[model samples]
Target: MKKERCDAASGVESIELDATVVATIRFKAVPPQLLEVDIALCDAAAAGQVDMYNSTPLFVAATGGCTGAVDTLLKHGAEISCSVLYETCHYGQAEAVAILLDHGAKVFANTGQQNPMCAAARPGSVKILELLHECGFDINPSDQGMISTPLHEASEIGYVAVVEWLLTHGANVDATDGAGKTSLHHAVNRRHSDVVTSLLDHGAQADIQDTVRSYRASRGKYDIVQLLLANVSNTQRNLTVTS
Candidate 1:
């Protein structure tokens, strides 16, 4: 009897059920009716299967952005926490995230291996970002350790809206990551001209160099290099006049 594996990407595991049975319970394919039946038959059947990395029914449903499935699972006593929230944020499932939050899920749930705010930043959904903020997600949390703030992620990915929102909400424009690279450094490295411009407008320090390498020397994005240099020169001139 070969042990059946749940979706490897989901990191779920199941008992040695038949492959067909496992297939019927997949996150994408399982209808609400079938999910109810499966859960009733084996509430502890790992929902999709218990993997080292994946949680149960809630995590699986959230990952798929199946809001209906998530509702059903939550009603069935699925623990709402960071794991589920992180998955929904990663998939950009705003509706699922809303439902979870309505059901008393913690916005700052201990993100096991995922950062919920950081994940939200990548997709540039202002609504979700605002919702997380309303629920007490720090706009500039340093808990990410070496990963830096949501602003850094947004800037690196060229999410101008998210970057703007973070700045408006008090995210430190010059916060550095474990690599000592600020959001400006990331925006400059990626050559996201619009993001670089927005960061500068929001008071990001253009002259701050990263510990690993110089932004001006590493990439030859002439426009971006010129923009950074121009900002630095303007600031220096202002200081000289003030002195």
Candidate 2:
């Protein structure tokens, strides 16, 4: 009998398993209210689940300008020093940013790729920039790695108001990026005539050359090229008269 049992066990295949012996799997249906309670009880559980881009629920809420959600997460002890701060700035969520800052988020914190100030520049909102400045961040913080100044970002995107605000805050108009390109170079290259004008009004050097091209010859925008040339000539004439 023992020999016969051993032979039967050896002959059993995966597909030959008895249906009655197989484990049954089932999901219990819960009421919506109960599900909500369960989620609330385990709210901390999903807080650490990151998406493919490594963003958490708080990051999503902050980036979407959801101040209420941000507040709730902060109350739940979510981390305040993550990229969500930069996301708030990037999306122009001034209120969300303020909430994060009030909870001890660093104004100049770098989120691996860009800092809050750099993110704010992309939206070109003077209000956001002012908030960051009021929080004690340097208006002219030195560039790190490949990151450019806020002025460079604002100029490149043609944000006249933001450019003006940065200039008023004493941002270096001639501050260069990794390639030695100044804000004037960015504005002219992107054909933002108004931004280029603003930079020149703020004393951006018209003759500064980047690694590959001078500000005047950086782009095919005729008006920008003409503006740079005229500004350069005027600067030279003023210097000659002074001398």
| Number of the predicted model whose lDDT against the real structure is largest | 1
Top candidate when judged by TM-score against the true structure: 1
Task: Summarize candidate 1's per-residue lDDT along 129-166 as a digit string, tens digits.
Answer: 88788787777765353477889889888999999999
- The candidate 2 region of ten consecutive residues with least summed lDDT is 17-26
lDDT of each: 0.69, 0.65
Model 2 global lDDT (CA atoms, 0 to 1): 0.65
List candidate 1 stretches off by more than 4 Å. 1-24, 27-53, 107-114, 143-146, 211-213, 217-220, 234-243
Of candidate 1, the 10-residue stretch with the lowest lDDT total is 209-218
TM-score of each: 0.75, 0.71
